[model samples]
Target: MKKVVVTGVGIVSPLGIGKQANWDGVTSGRSGIGPISLFEPDEGLITKFAGEIPEFDATHWLSKPEARRYDRFLHVALAAGLEAVEDSGLVIDDSNAQRVATILGVGLGGMPFLEETIGQRIATRKLRRVSPFFIPGLIANMAPGLLSIYTGARGESWTATSACASANHAIGASLRALRSGACDVALTGGAEAVVCHTTIAGFNAMKALSTRNDDPATASRPFDSGRDGFVLGEGAAVLVLETEEHAQARGATVYAEVAGFGATADAHHITAPRPDGDGAVQAMSMALQDGGLAREQVGYINAHGTSTPANDKMETAAIRTLFGDHAERLAVSSTKSMTGHLLGAAAAVEAVFSVMALQQGILPPTINQFASDPECDLDYIPHQARKAEVEVALSNSLGFGGTNAAVAFRSAR
Candidate 1:
């Protein structure tokens, strides 16, 4: 089997744009959640905050006319994908373009775009006023489609829409393809731009969002006793993956090894997690088993602590059940404390953070941990970063419809 390794990473996070900015923000425990700047929230909207990128112009990556053709998700997808290719320094010419795959995960697609075209524009004007780019920009697959077109990767291109686990599934699929010789290289990740009025309204209606409008920065206090719920966020991330042999043959800089991937369905709830955390335990165990790593081998876990009442406790119980005493030793954290919840893009962004942790030998802190919940007790590396020699790291993502996914990363060095 071909060993899967990461060569490059690009991020479009609220922490900042690009890889280094996100690294600095997360490692320093900076919170990006604040009042929504993407659009004016309804006066009576319960949740008024989100992790939105301020002053982002899609024309920076796409031409003016091209930018008008696609939705925000595709815009960020192209930007992040291009940045990853440049960071990897991989030349995708006529010969190797066919050997490169592009798989991007997107959960919401162009909901905002569709809503605007149908609800607002069409309602105010005639159907003829609608732009012709509506369908192409409104589809979820266009994130990968536009990214592939930009990168010239013609191999096995598609998108994953597995709710929040979309990116993990996309990454896992690319690893499988690489191991099976289906592709020599893969550009895979996720993009989400659902911080619009409709998304915020919907999540608020379901009580899945935090209503801490008074204190936006501290709203995403994962595992904290006074936590309310996750804050909606928008971002995109792309990882350049290639076989170990291929990467070495071309002298590419290796970031980390994609040791194992585990994805499972909870089959229990649509939006809530099972209290027993059985599916999460299975996913984490499968990742360890697939990587031939014992529970003690994993030094850090980028937890899916959504700051919700159910998820944090469930994830804590799952870790304890699977790792025994090692769970106590693990530096578990939720970067959602800073970036809010990026929905489908959460796994991809957290995967990059896990790889960064292994490479830097540092664990990013989960800030706003002033208080703790008894059911969610663990070494959360709270409020501050910690210096640790991390060898193996686990990134977990649990999504709606009981979807659970875990990906294990091993230090390249």
Candidate 2:
């Protein structure tokens, strides 16, 4: 198999608009959660808080005409993809552009747009009232499709949806394609912008959202006894993955090696994780085997700690089962506590955090963990960042469909 390395990364999250800004916020233990400002929630909505990307100017990333055609989700994806491509510093001309692919994950694709169109149709009662670009803007695959079109990348382009694990699946699939000689370079990541009435109502009805509207920052407290549920967030994160030979040939600065990827289905429940965390353990074990790494070599873990009771405890159990003696020595943190839950984009953003940890030797903190629970008895790096020499890092992402994925990364020495 070909050696895969991350040459560049991009992020558009609630903390900030760019990669460095987001990293600084995560490392500094800042919280981005606040009351929802996109739409009023007084109209019978249970949850009224979200982690919205503040001060975002769509015109900065998209042309006025282009912005009209695409939805907000596509705009985020395109902006992040462009940032990743620019960071890679790879001069992809017409001759080499065909070798670059785009694979992005999106969970709720254009839900806001769908709702808007439906409302318009009901009010006007005209079939021709819908915008011509509505269908293209609402498709899940259009996230990557827009990237390919903008960058002139003619290689394989598609979107993967595995609930919250969508981005990890997309990144792992891109690495496999590159290793199989299908593509030399790829842009992979995830995006989600579904903080609207319909989605919020559904999540609220299911009791899956945090209702701490008074104190938004303290709402997402992962591993804490007072934890309630996750705060809905919207953002996108993208990465540039290239073959080691390809990156070296271009003298690109490699961040870290995409050592391994493991995926499994719980086959047990639709929303809840397996009671014993069997799927998570299996996924972590497979990732270690795939990376040819020992359990002790993993210095840090970016956990899927979704600030929920079941997920936090189950993920902790899974780690203890997989790592055994090494579990206590690992530095684990949940960036979600700071960035809120970006749903499909969670794994992609955390993957960027893992790579950055290995490169900068700084572990981001799992903020908002005031009172630790006995079940989640691990080094969560609570409330503050830590400086550690990390050689290898693992990121875990679990989704609602009982889908789990673990990705391993090694420092580019």
Residue by residue across 1-413, what tens digits does model 2's lDDT show?
78999999999999999998998999999999998998777669988899999987778988898887888889899889899999999767798888999999898899888777666687778766678888998899999999998888888999999999999999999989889989999999899988898889999988989899889999999999999998999999999999999999999999999999999999999999998999999988888888899899999999999998899999999999999998989999999998999888899999999999999989999989778799999999989999999888999999989999999999986
- Candidate 1's TM-score: 0.98
Residue-by-residue lDDT tens digits, candidate 1, 98-187? 999999888889978887767787667777667788999879999888888887889989999888889988888888899899999999
- Flag regions of model 1 displaced more than 4 Å: none
Q: Candidate 2, which ten residues in sequence have the lowest lDDT sum? A: 115-124
Pairs with steric clashes in candidate 2: none
Off by more than 4 A, model 2: 123-128
Candidates' lDDT values, in order? Answer: 0.90, 0.91
Give all TM-scores, in the order shown. Answer: 0.98, 0.98
